[model samples]
Target: MPADFHRIASGRPAAGSTSFEAQVLPYLDAAYNLARWLARDDADAQDVVQEAMLRAFRYFDSFRGGDARVWLLAIVRNTFYSLRMKVPPDGMQETFDDDAHAVVDEQPTPEARMLIALDVGALQKALENLPHPLRETIVLRELEECSYKEIASITGQKIGTVMSRLARARERLRAELTRHSTEVRRHDVQ
Candidate 1:
């Protein structure tokens, strides 16, 4: 569990007056998650987040804050777009396994772990295959658990557009996973 994830007695995020760092710091992992998926490289993601933080600090006064997380994420997403255009994606082929950073309690049996890996890997690859718009929408809505309104704010799309993309993304993901499972079963049968 992240040290920053603590909630107050009401089991809700604590509320307070906004200090730039204080507002942004708690959502660093969320920012990094968005960045990592956008960049598809962990190192690049970190660089994007660092640059995004700086941009946030530079423009702090403009934030007419409603939701600070959305504000920071918008900056992070834009920073990624900037990085993507300025630098070639091929410039860095380096990759890191996210499993390395994930903390697991109590090892699963080998059989269970292998099954889990297969499903997770297939879903991940399927997600990577989705078009950027669909992918981004799904990531914000599902993985980040943002509302349709929040997703629209982050992605600069209408709420209806966000919902449409999510529906399309989910259908594509389901098809991809089903195809993978069928192929695996066929291989096993042979």
Candidate 2:
């Protein structure tokens, strides 16, 4: 048997009892994905996820019967922020260029449209450029398919704040994609 199987078997709670793996492990992918987007570094994301999991395990007893995914994600977000605060502030400076938000022309040729099909690298870079709050909102709503309520709960924000952040994130993402598409078309013409 696989090690995981043995662990599950040995750690199985009695009927009607909460099983840690059953509730928490199932959400590991979501947790890791969120961490990756927030941390923007594979190793750092892994560290965040591991720390979050340990913290979740340590606090498992306090978890009431509710959405385990939300509970776990809340822990992940908190862990990521805690780790973020510990890093030296000097290395974290990011200059926000106002011109990056300028609206670009939207004229799309057939060829340009064809070339615009899901450019993962460009999209990732655009997302990386977003502020962490906006990026996290987009990831939770679009990537994780979380509801606004869930996002608000996980992020510890008001529902209105979550809505505004998501709206701004989408608008920024649209602007980024448009800018990227224009650049790609110009490159093709060269």
Candidate 3:
């Protein structure tokens, strides 16, 4: 194990003694990924991740011995929510249209099917369009692969709530992907 990760596994550091790179740096990717999904913008996600790292380092003494990823993710979620409260609601809230997301079965060509499989941009756009609560649940559960208990702890919700949110989020994601696939096929045909 690398020295930085070693420190993190050892648990709570002595007061002002732990290096930020040692304890907090190990989980930066997870932090940034969660932040990115929550913030839905590169710049905002970076800002949120930076703030989360700072806050985590400052409060390193409070962390008990356990999964550092979960701890860091919890901080990131809290920071994003706090930031959300600070900003006025952007008037651009998008309502999901079941009609728009409906799947139309036009027999797609082989190339179109391949392109749809590789269309990461569309999947990301669909995720971005989801409501924050649903998006966050999906990101934590599917993207981060965190357990329901871990997600519950991070989001401060009960495990049942987390499971419910994830189910709803997955259904919505399926609908979004179907819509994107149909649109991509249509574009390819035209």
TM-score of 3: 0.74
Superposing every Cα of model 1 onto the true structure, what RMSD results?
A: 6.8
> What does candidate 1's lDDT look like per residue over 9-118, in tens digits?
12433342136657777888889999888877888989999899777765766888799899989899999988888887676444446475433435898767777777
Ranking by TM-score: 1, 2, 3
Best by TM-score: 1
Model 2: per-residue lDDT, tens digit, 1-190? 1244335444544432347767888899999999988887667788999899878876777989799999999999999999889987543334333345333436877555444434655677788899889999999999999999999999999999999999999999999989988887788744
Q: Give, for candidate 1, the lowest lDDT window spanning 10 residues.
A: 1-10
- Give the whole-model CA lDDT for all candidates, comma-separated: 0.79, 0.80, 0.77
Clashing residue pairs in all predictions, respectively, total 0, 0, 0
Candidate 2 residue spans exceeding 4 A from truth: 1-18, 89-118
Candidate 2, overall lDDT? 0.80
Pairs clashing in candidate 3?
none
lDDT of 1 at 95: 47
Candidate achieving higher lDDT, 2 or 3: 2
Write down the TM-score for model 2.
0.77
lDDT of 1: 0.79
